[model samples]
Target: MDTEEKSNQLELETALNNQTLYWQANLKLLVKLLVVWFAVSFGCGIILVDWLDQFTIAGFKLGFWFAQQGAIYVFVALIFVYARQMKILDRQFDVGDDDSNQEPQS
Candidate 1:
Protein backbone atom coordinates (compact mmCIF):
# COMPACT_ATOMS: atom_id res chain seq x y z
CA MET A 1 0.00 0.00 0.00
CA ASP A 2 3.02 2.28 0.46
CA THR A 3 4.25 4.30 -2.53
CA GLU A 4 7.69 2.77 -2.25
CA GLU A 5 6.27 -0.76 -2.32
CA LYS A 6 4.14 0.02 -5.39
CA SER A 7 7.12 1.50 -7.23
CA ASN A 8 9.21 -1.57 -6.45
CA GLN A 9 6.46 -3.85 -7.65
CA LEU A 10 6.17 -1.92 -10.92
CA GLU A 11 9.89 -2.12 -11.49
CA LEU A 12 9.88 -5.85 -10.85
CA GLU A 13 6.98 -6.34 -13.27
CA THR A 14 8.77 -4.32 -15.94
CA ALA A 15 11.92 -6.38 -15.55
CA LEU A 16 9.92 -9.59 -15.76
CA ASN A 17 8.20 -8.38 -18.92
CA ASN A 18 11.52 -7.51 -20.52
CA GLN A 19 12.93 -10.90 -19.60
CA THR A 20 9.90 -12.64 -21.07
CA LEU A 21 10.22 -10.69 -24.29
CA TYR A 22 13.87 -11.62 -24.58
CA TRP A 23 13.12 -15.30 -24.09
CA GLN A 24 10.30 -15.27 -26.60
CA ALA A 25 12.55 -13.59 -29.14
CA ASN A 26 15.27 -16.15 -28.49
CA LEU A 27 12.91 -19.08 -28.89
CA LYS A 28 11.50 -17.69 -32.10
CA LEU A 29 14.97 -17.26 -33.53
CA LEU A 30 15.89 -20.81 -32.53
CA VAL A 31 12.75 -22.29 -34.08
CA LYS A 32 13.30 -20.42 -37.32
CA LEU A 33 16.89 -21.55 -37.57
CA LEU A 34 15.94 -25.13 -36.85
CA VAL A 35 13.29 -25.07 -39.54
CA VAL A 36 15.85 -23.84 -42.03
CA TRP A 37 18.27 -26.58 -41.02
CA PHE A 38 15.60 -29.23 -41.33
CA ALA A 39 14.49 -28.00 -44.70
CA VAL A 40 18.00 -28.04 -46.08
CA SER A 41 19.10 -31.33 -44.51
CA PHE A 42 15.94 -33.37 -44.85
CA GLY A 43 13.73 -31.78 -47.44
CA CYS A 44 16.26 -30.92 -50.11
CA GLY A 45 18.57 -33.85 -49.41
CA ILE A 46 15.96 -36.58 -49.16
CA ILE A 47 12.32 -35.72 -49.69
CA LEU A 48 12.79 -33.62 -52.79
CA VAL A 49 15.87 -35.29 -54.17
CA ASP A 50 14.07 -37.10 -56.92
CA TRP A 51 12.29 -34.00 -58.01
CA LEU A 52 15.45 -31.96 -57.83
CA ASP A 53 17.40 -34.56 -59.78
CA GLN A 54 15.77 -33.22 -62.89
CA PHE A 55 18.17 -30.28 -62.69
CA THR A 56 21.93 -30.19 -63.14
CA ILE A 57 24.67 -27.86 -62.06
CA ALA A 58 28.05 -27.87 -63.82
CA GLY A 59 27.72 -31.58 -64.72
CA PHE A 60 26.50 -32.50 -61.22
CA LYS A 61 22.94 -33.55 -60.55
CA LEU A 62 21.25 -31.12 -58.17
CA GLY A 63 19.90 -33.86 -55.98
CA PHE A 64 23.26 -35.57 -55.61
CA TRP A 65 24.87 -32.25 -54.77
CA PHE A 66 22.22 -31.54 -52.16
CA ALA A 67 22.70 -34.94 -50.58
CA GLN A 68 26.45 -34.99 -50.62
CA GLN A 69 27.49 -31.37 -50.14
CA GLY A 70 24.71 -28.85 -50.29
CA ALA A 71 23.23 -29.79 -46.97
CA ILE A 72 26.58 -29.50 -45.21
CA TYR A 73 27.17 -26.13 -46.79
CA VAL A 74 23.76 -24.97 -45.67
CA PHE A 75 24.40 -26.23 -42.18
CA VAL A 76 27.59 -24.23 -41.92
CA ALA A 77 25.90 -21.16 -43.26
CA LEU A 78 23.12 -21.64 -40.74
CA ILE A 79 25.67 -21.72 -37.95
CA PHE A 80 26.87 -18.30 -38.97
CA VAL A 81 23.32 -17.06 -39.28
CA TYR A 82 22.47 -18.29 -35.81
CA ALA A 83 25.54 -16.69 -34.33
CA ARG A 84 24.81 -13.34 -35.92
CA GLN A 85 21.19 -13.44 -34.85
CA MET A 86 22.09 -14.37 -31.29
CA LYS A 87 24.59 -11.55 -31.10
CA ILE A 88 21.91 -9.11 -32.12
CA LEU A 89 19.50 -10.64 -29.64
CA ASP A 90 22.05 -10.45 -26.86
CA ARG A 91 22.52 -6.74 -27.49
CA GLN A 92 18.77 -6.18 -27.65
CA PHE A 93 18.26 -8.01 -24.36
CA ASP A 94 21.09 -6.04 -22.71
CA VAL A 95 22.74 -9.37 -21.90
CA GLY A 96 25.84 -8.98 -24.03
CA ASP A 97 29.17 -8.51 -22.29
CA ASP A 98 29.98 -4.82 -21.86
CA ASP A 99 33.51 -4.98 -20.55
CA SER A 100 34.90 -4.71 -24.04
CA ASN A 101 33.06 -1.45 -24.59
CA GLN A 102 34.08 0.19 -21.30
CA GLU A 103 37.00 2.58 -21.12
CA PRO A 104 39.67 1.63 -18.60
CA GLN A 105 39.92 4.02 -15.68
CA SER A 106 43.33 5.58 -15.20
Candidate 2:
Protein backbone atom coordinates (compact mmCIF):
# COMPACT_ATOMS: atom_id res chain seq x y z
CA MET A 1 0.00 0.00 0.00
CA ASP A 2 1.00 3.63 -0.58
CA THR A 3 2.42 5.74 2.27
CA GLU A 4 -0.70 7.93 2.73
CA GLU A 5 -3.11 4.99 2.72
CA LYS A 6 -0.87 2.96 5.02
CA SER A 7 -0.63 5.88 7.42
CA ASN A 8 -4.39 6.20 7.47
CA GLN A 9 -4.75 2.49 8.15
CA LEU A 10 -2.30 2.67 11.02
CA GLU A 11 -4.20 5.55 12.59
CA LEU A 12 -7.49 3.70 12.24
CA GLU A 13 -6.05 0.60 13.86
CA THR A 14 -4.68 2.59 16.77
CA ALA A 15 -8.02 4.29 17.43
CA LEU A 16 -9.93 1.00 17.21
CA ASN A 17 -7.55 -0.68 19.63
CA ASN A 18 -7.95 2.18 22.05
CA GLN A 19 -11.72 2.05 21.70
CA THR A 20 -11.79 -1.65 22.54
CA LEU A 21 -9.62 -1.10 25.59
CA TYR A 22 -11.80 1.79 26.71
CA TRP A 23 -14.95 -0.38 26.49
CA GLN A 24 -13.32 -3.16 28.48
CA ALA A 25 -12.30 -0.74 31.20
CA ASN A 26 -15.77 0.76 31.30
CA LEU A 27 -17.36 -2.69 31.59
CA LYS A 28 -15.11 -3.57 34.49
CA LEU A 29 -16.06 -0.39 36.28
CA LEU A 30 -19.74 -1.04 35.70
CA VAL A 31 -19.48 -4.59 37.02
CA LYS A 32 -17.72 -3.39 40.15
CA LEU A 33 -20.33 -0.74 40.81
CA LEU A 34 -23.17 -3.19 40.30
CA VAL A 35 -21.63 -5.71 42.64
CA VAL A 36 -21.28 -3.05 45.30
CA TRP A 37 -24.84 -1.97 44.70
CA PHE A 38 -26.11 -5.49 45.13
CA ALA A 39 -24.07 -5.94 48.26
CA VAL A 40 -25.54 -2.85 49.89
CA SER A 41 -29.07 -3.40 48.67
CA PHE A 42 -29.55 -7.13 49.03
CA GLY A 43 -26.72 -8.15 51.33
CA CYS A 44 -27.40 -5.49 53.91
CA GLY A 45 -31.10 -5.00 53.36
CA ILE A 46 -32.18 -8.65 53.26
CA ILE A 47 -29.33 -11.02 54.07
CA LEU A 48 -27.98 -9.32 57.18
CA VAL A 49 -30.93 -7.42 58.51
CA ASP A 50 -30.83 -8.92 62.01
CA TRP A 51 -27.17 -8.01 62.47
CA LEU A 52 -27.53 -4.54 60.97
CA ASP A 53 -30.59 -3.62 63.01
CA GLN A 54 -28.45 -3.52 66.16
CA PHE A 55 -27.00 -0.15 65.11
CA THR A 56 -29.84 2.20 64.34
CA ILE A 57 -28.95 5.47 62.66
CA ALA A 58 -31.54 8.15 63.53
CA GLY A 59 -34.96 6.59 64.11
CA PHE A 60 -34.79 4.09 61.26
CA LYS A 61 -33.35 0.58 61.57
CA LEU A 62 -30.12 -0.04 59.70
CA GLY A 63 -31.57 -2.61 57.35
CA PHE A 64 -34.46 -0.27 56.65
CA TRP A 65 -31.85 2.41 56.04
CA PHE A 66 -30.19 0.22 53.45
CA ALA A 67 -33.47 -0.64 51.75
CA GLN A 68 -35.07 2.79 51.78
CA GLN A 69 -32.57 5.65 51.57
CA GLY A 70 -29.09 4.18 51.53
CA ALA A 71 -29.47 2.20 48.34
CA ILE A 72 -31.04 5.14 46.51
CA TYR A 73 -28.28 7.46 47.65
CA VAL A 74 -25.68 4.95 46.64
CA PHE A 75 -27.26 4.54 43.20
CA VAL A 76 -27.15 8.26 42.57
CA ALA A 77 -23.57 8.44 43.70
CA LEU A 78 -22.69 5.54 41.44
CA ILE A 79 -24.11 7.37 38.43
CA PHE A 80 -21.91 10.40 38.96
CA VAL A 81 -18.92 8.29 39.86
CA TYR A 82 -19.25 6.26 36.69
CA ALA A 83 -19.49 9.37 34.57
CA ARG A 84 -16.44 10.95 36.17
CA GLN A 85 -14.41 7.75 35.93
CA MET A 86 -15.28 7.25 32.27
CA LYS A 87 -14.26 10.79 31.46
CA ILE A 88 -10.88 10.11 33.02
CA LEU A 89 -10.67 6.84 31.14
CA ASP A 90 -11.42 8.62 27.89
CA ARG A 91 -8.54 11.02 28.42
CA GLN A 92 -6.24 8.24 29.50
CA PHE A 93 -6.98 6.26 26.32
CA ASP A 94 -6.31 9.29 24.09
CA VAL A 95 -10.03 9.36 23.25
CA GLY A 96 -10.63 12.97 24.10
CA ASP A 97 -13.12 15.24 22.38
CA ASP A 98 -11.39 14.94 19.03
CA ASP A 99 -12.67 13.71 15.70
CA SER A 100 -9.44 11.84 15.03
CA ASN A 101 -10.40 9.41 17.77
CA GLN A 102 -13.49 8.33 15.84
CA GLU A 103 -13.46 5.50 13.33
CA PRO A 104 -11.66 6.79 10.24
CA GLN A 105 -13.27 4.51 7.68
CA SER A 106 -16.77 5.97 7.98
Candidate 3:
Protein backbone atom coordinates (compact mmCIF):
# COMPACT_ATOMS: atom_id res chain seq x y z
CA MET A 1 0.00 0.00 0.00
CA ASP A 2 1.07 3.61 -0.50
CA THR A 3 2.29 5.53 2.53
CA GLU A 4 -0.84 7.73 2.45
CA GLU A 5 -3.12 4.72 2.31
CA LYS A 6 -1.25 3.11 5.23
CA SER A 7 -1.60 6.26 7.29
CA ASN A 8 -5.31 6.48 6.65
CA GLN A 9 -5.81 2.84 7.62
CA LEU A 10 -3.86 3.32 10.78
CA GLU A 11 -5.88 6.36 11.75
CA LEU A 12 -9.14 4.56 11.17
CA GLU A 13 -8.02 1.65 13.29
CA THR A 14 -6.99 4.01 16.07
CA ALA A 15 -10.38 5.69 16.09
CA LEU A 16 -12.32 2.46 16.33
CA ASN A 17 -10.08 1.26 19.12
CA ASN A 18 -10.56 4.56 20.93
CA GLN A 19 -14.32 4.19 20.82
CA THR A 20 -14.08 0.73 22.34
CA LEU A 21 -11.84 2.09 25.04
CA TYR A 22 -14.24 4.89 25.84
CA TRP A 23 -17.03 2.40 26.44
CA GLN A 24 -14.83 0.28 28.68
CA ALA A 25 -13.88 3.27 30.78
CA ASN A 26 -17.52 4.25 30.93
CA LEU A 27 -18.49 0.78 32.16
CA LYS A 28 -15.80 0.74 34.82
CA LEU A 29 -16.77 4.13 36.18
CA LEU A 30 -20.40 3.09 36.27
CA VAL A 31 -19.60 0.01 38.31
CA LYS A 32 -17.44 1.98 40.69
CA LEU A 33 -20.23 4.49 41.22
CA LEU A 34 -22.72 1.75 41.98
CA VAL A 35 -20.54 -0.01 44.54
CA VAL A 36 -19.69 3.20 46.31
CA TRP A 37 -23.32 4.22 46.18
CA PHE A 38 -24.41 1.00 47.84
CA ALA A 39 -21.68 1.17 50.45
CA VAL A 40 -22.53 4.67 51.53
CA SER A 41 -26.31 4.70 51.23
CA PHE A 42 -27.08 1.18 52.36
CA GLY A 43 -24.10 0.13 54.40
CA CYS A 44 -23.52 3.26 56.40
CA GLY A 45 -26.98 4.71 56.20
CA ILE A 46 -28.94 1.67 57.21
CA ILE A 47 -27.18 -1.63 57.87
CA LEU A 48 -24.09 -0.71 59.88
CA VAL A 49 -24.73 2.64 61.52
CA ASP A 50 -25.52 1.24 64.94
CA TRP A 51 -22.46 -0.97 64.97
CA LEU A 52 -20.31 1.70 63.38
CA ASP A 53 -21.50 4.24 65.89
CA GLN A 54 -19.78 2.18 68.57
CA PHE A 55 -16.59 3.77 67.30
CA THR A 56 -15.91 7.26 66.05
CA ILE A 57 -13.61 8.72 63.45
CA ALA A 58 -11.95 11.74 65.09
CA GLY A 59 -14.67 11.70 67.72
CA PHE A 60 -17.29 12.64 65.17
CA LYS A 61 -20.52 10.87 65.92
CA LEU A 62 -20.95 8.11 63.36
CA GLY A 63 -24.59 7.01 63.24
CA PHE A 64 -25.90 10.50 63.77
CA TRP A 65 -23.62 11.76 61.06
CA PHE A 66 -24.89 9.17 58.68
CA ALA A 67 -28.44 10.07 59.43
CA GLN A 68 -27.78 13.78 59.35
CA GLN A 69 -24.90 14.92 57.11
CA GLY A 70 -21.81 12.74 56.90
CA ALA A 71 -23.04 10.30 54.31
CA ILE A 72 -24.37 13.14 52.18
CA TYR A 73 -21.07 14.97 52.26
CA VAL A 74 -19.27 11.79 51.32
CA PHE A 75 -21.71 11.24 48.48
CA VAL A 76 -21.19 14.74 47.16
CA ALA A 77 -17.46 14.43 47.46
CA LEU A 78 -17.57 11.12 45.66
CA ILE A 79 -19.29 12.81 42.75
CA PHE A 80 -16.40 15.21 42.27
CA VAL A 81 -13.86 12.55 43.05
CA TYR A 82 -15.36 10.19 40.52
CA ALA A 83 -15.32 12.96 37.98
CA ARG A 84 -11.62 13.44 38.58
CA GLN A 85 -10.88 9.76 38.70
CA MET A 86 -12.80 9.13 35.50
CA LYS A 87 -10.63 11.65 33.72
CA ILE A 88 -7.57 9.73 34.79
CA LEU A 89 -9.14 6.49 33.79
CA ASP A 90 -10.15 7.82 30.38
CA ARG A 91 -6.67 9.08 29.70
CA GLN A 92 -5.20 5.84 30.92
CA PHE A 93 -7.35 4.03 28.40
CA ASP A 94 -6.40 6.49 25.66
CA VAL A 95 -10.07 7.04 24.92
CA GLY A 96 -10.70 10.37 26.56
CA ASP A 97 -12.98 12.64 24.63
CA ASP A 98 -12.30 16.36 24.46
CA ASP A 99 -14.51 16.59 27.53
CA SER A 100 -12.86 13.79 29.42
CA ASN A 101 -13.42 15.55 32.70
CA GLN A 102 -17.14 15.06 32.29
CA GLU A 103 -18.31 11.75 33.67
CA PRO A 104 -20.13 9.40 31.29
CA GLN A 105 -23.84 8.74 31.41
CA SER A 106 -24.75 5.77 33.55
Q: Which has the greatest TM-score?
A: 1
Q: Per-residue lDDT tens digits of candidate 1, residues 1-106? A: 6999999999778877877998999899989999999898799999999999999998888988999999999899988998899888777867665675432322
List of clashing residue pairs for candidate 1 = none
Summarize candidate 3's per-residue lDDT along 49-105 as a digit string, tens digits. Answer: 898788776666687678677778878988898889877776776555767444353
lDDT of 1: 0.85
TM-score for each predicted model, relative to the true structure: 0.85, 0.78, 0.63
**Over the full model, what C-alpha lDDT does candidate 2 score relative to the true structure?**
0.85
Q: Write the per-residue lDDT of candidate 2 for residues 2-96, one digit (tens) a residue.
A: 99999999988987898899999989999999998899888988898879988889998998899888988988998899889987897788666
Sorted by lDDT (best first), the order is 2, 1, 3
Estimate the TM-score for candidate 3: 0.63
Which sections of candidate 3 miss by over 4 Å?
Answer: 1-10, 56-61, 89-106
Shift in Å, residue 21, candidate 2: 1.0
Candidate 2 residue 41 C-alpha distance from true site, Å: 1.0
lDDT (Cα) of model 3: 0.77
Position 89, candidate 1: lDDT: 79
Question: Which regions of candidate 2 are displaced past 4 Å?
Answer: 96-105
Better of 2 and 3 by lDDT: 2
